[model samples]
Target: MISGRICIGLCFIALAMQVSSAMAEVFTYPALRSSQASDPEQSLLTSTQPMAVIYGSADIGAFVPVIEAFQQDNPFIGVEYHQLQTLEMYDITQSQRANGEPAADLIISSSMDLQMKLANDGYATSYQSSETDALPHWARWRNEAFAVTQEPAVIAYNREFFRENELEPPRTREDFIRLLVNHDELLSEKVTTYDIERSGVGFLFLARDERFFPGIWDFVRILGQAKVKLYSNTSPMLEKIASGQVVLGYNLLGSYAETFTQRNPNLGVILPDDFIVVYSRIAIIPRGARNPDLGGRFLDFMLSIKGQSVLQNEGNFNPVRADVPPSTFSSLIFDRYGERVRSFPVGPGLLVYLDQAKRQRFLRRWQDALLNRR
Candidate 1:
C-alpha cells in the first residue's frame, strides 16, 4: 500500500482534476475544446458577452453573484471569468505574453506572492484612480497590484472534540506547540495542516511564519513528532475535521472556516492572539490585456461602495475596504487579533521567499523535520 502522505498526494490530484478541469480546458483550448465549444459548459458562453477577465481564484464561484450585480448596472458589459490555479495562471500569463498570445485581462489570486512577483517583474499595468487611491498603502504597491480581500490564516478545530475533552483552544503558536506536546498521543493522527510542499499558499504562510517567529521550527518539530496529517487545500482538510478524522487544523483560511460554522457548529475558528497572518487576495490588470480599460472599470466597480457591499453580502468576500462595516466574523477577528494582525504587505517583500537559493534552504530545513518525521 502507498504511504499515507503519498495517498494524500494522489487524492489531491483527483480533487484537482475535478475542480480544475473546466479552468484547464478554457486556458488550454487547442487540446480540450471541440470546434463547437459554443455552450457555456464547453466555452463558458453566457448572454451579453463582451469583456472577459481570466482570474485565478479557488473560490471563483463566489464571483458570480457579485458580478451579476455589476451586470445589473452595466448590462451591456459582461465580464467572463476564467479561473485557474494561482501559480499556473501566473506562469501561463508570462509564457503567453512571451509567445505573443492572448492572456488574462485581470489576474486575481490568493497567492499574493506570485501576484506580487508578476507586478515586480513588470507584468502588471500601472493605473491609478479614485478606486486604487482608496486602498491602504500596504494593500497597493506602485499603483499596480491591489489587495481585494481581508482574510486570515487561522487555527480551526473540531468544537465537539475540544468540548468533550474540556481542552482550552490555543490562542498562539506557543500555545499550539504546548497543546501538541502535551497531547501527542491523543493527536497522534488526529491533527491536520497544510502540506507546504504541494501547496503555494501553505508555502507562503509557513515561510512568513519563519520570518516573524523564531520558534516556528520548534513547533514544526512538535507537529512532526505528533504525526500531523497534511493536506493540499482547505476544503478537503476541513472535511476530515468535520467528519471527526481530524481534531485540529492549522493555517486554514478564516473566511472559509466561517462558512463551515453555519452547518457544522462543531467546527470552530480562532485567530491567534500573539500573532495572526492576514492575507489579501491581490488583483492586477495584466500589462498585455486586451481589455485594459474594461479591467480598470471592473476594478473601480469592485472598489465602489455598491460593489464592495455586494461582495461582502452576496459573495461572502472579506472586505478590504475601510468603509464596509465589519461582519460579525470580521469583528471577532479584529477583537481577538487586535494589533497582533500582521497584514503582509503587497510588494517585493513577498518575493524574498521565492528566491531559488532561499526556497531550497527553507525546504531543506522543512524536510529535515517534517518529511523525516513522516
Candidate 2:
C-alpha cells in the first residue's frame, strides 16, 4: 500500500513536471544567429564589429534602444543581447564558469538573490568606475554586482472596471484584502498573483513580503479564499487585467506594469500606501568573461546618466542612479512615494531563503496558506 506521504510527494513531482511543460510551451529562447540575421529576437542591434555579449532576462524590444544608444557612443563595439529566463541566466553562468568558459561579457537579471549568489561564490569579477562610484550605497555590492533599476512590486488593476463600478482601487495590502472580502462575489476568481514556486523573482518578492509585513500570510490566505489566479510571469496577469478577465494583479513588477499601462490606458498601477518593496535588476560581469574590458565598459555605460536615461526613457526601466531626473514613469512614482519605497539592498542577506531546505519549507508554508492544504 502506498503511504499518504509518498502519494503527496509523487503529486508534487507531477505538478512540477506539468509546470515545467507549461512554461516550455509558453516560453521559447531565441537562438543566436549571425549579425545579418533578420530575426529581431536574435540580436538587439546587428553589427559586424567586435562583439560584446549580454545575457539578460529583459525583453529584447524594451532593451534594444539602450543597446543601440550604447553603440552610438561606442561605435567600434557591437552588442549581442540574448534573453533568458532569470533562473536560466544564473544556471548557465554557473555551469559555464565551472567548465572554465564564461557565457557572456555581462549578465542582467531580475533575480537579485541568484545574482548575489554568483558574486558571493566568486563567480563574478569586480570593477569600479566613476559611474559605479557614484551609485547609492545600497545599490552596489563590493563593486561586483550593481543594481541598474529601481522597480517596485506593485498592484495592477483594470481602471475602467473600477471607474464603471464606482469602486476605488486598492492602495494598500490591507485595502486589497478588504476589497476582496467585501466584494467576494464580484472578485471571486478575478484576482491574480505570482505562483512563487515557479518564478524566481516572484519567490524573492514573497520572501521579502513575509519579512517586511507581519500580515503577509493572512493576506495570502485572503487571496487564496478569493480564488486568486496564479501565473509564473507578469505579462499574462497584466493582459488578463487589461482584458478584464482578472480585475487585479498583486505584487507585479512596477516597471513592467507602468510600461504595459502606457499602451493600455485602462490598466492602472498602485504602489501600496503602507509600504513599497522595490527590486532592481542587478548587473554583473562573469569571472570568466572573454571580454572583461568590454564588459566593464558596458557596465560603466549602463550606470552612466546617458545609459540610465535610455533605460528610463526607452527601456521603460527605472534608473538606479540618483542623478537621473524624475521624468520617467517609475521615477515620478519614486519622487512621490520615496518615503514608502523599501529598496531591497545588495548583500548576503538575500541568500537566506535560497537554502534548499529553507526554500522548500517556505514553499510548504506558503502552499498551506495559499492552497488551503494541510
True-structure RMSD, every candidate = 8.0, 9.8
Model 1: per-residue lDDT, tens digit, 1-374? 11111111111111222144223422211111123345658565533345556566755445655566666667666555655667667767777677776667778888888899989999999989998898878889999999888778889898888999899879889999989888888889888888887678888888878878999988888888888899877887777888789989988977677776676888888888778888888889998897888788888888777887777665556777788787776776666566887777888998886898988998889878874563
Distance (Å) between predicted and true CA of 220, model 1? 0.8
| Residue 320 lDDT, candidate 2, scale 0-100 | 83
The residue ranges of model 1 lying beyond 4 angstroms of the native Cα positions read: 1-48, 372-374
Q: Summing lDDT over every window of 10 consecutive residues in candidate 1, give the lowest-scoring window.
A: 2-11
Candidate 2 residue runs with Cα over 4 Å from true position = 1-48, 328-331
* TM-score for each of the candidates: 0.84, 0.85
lDDT of 2: 0.80
Give the 10-residue window scoring lowest on summed lDDT in candidate 2: 5-14
Q: lDDT score of model 1?
A: 0.75
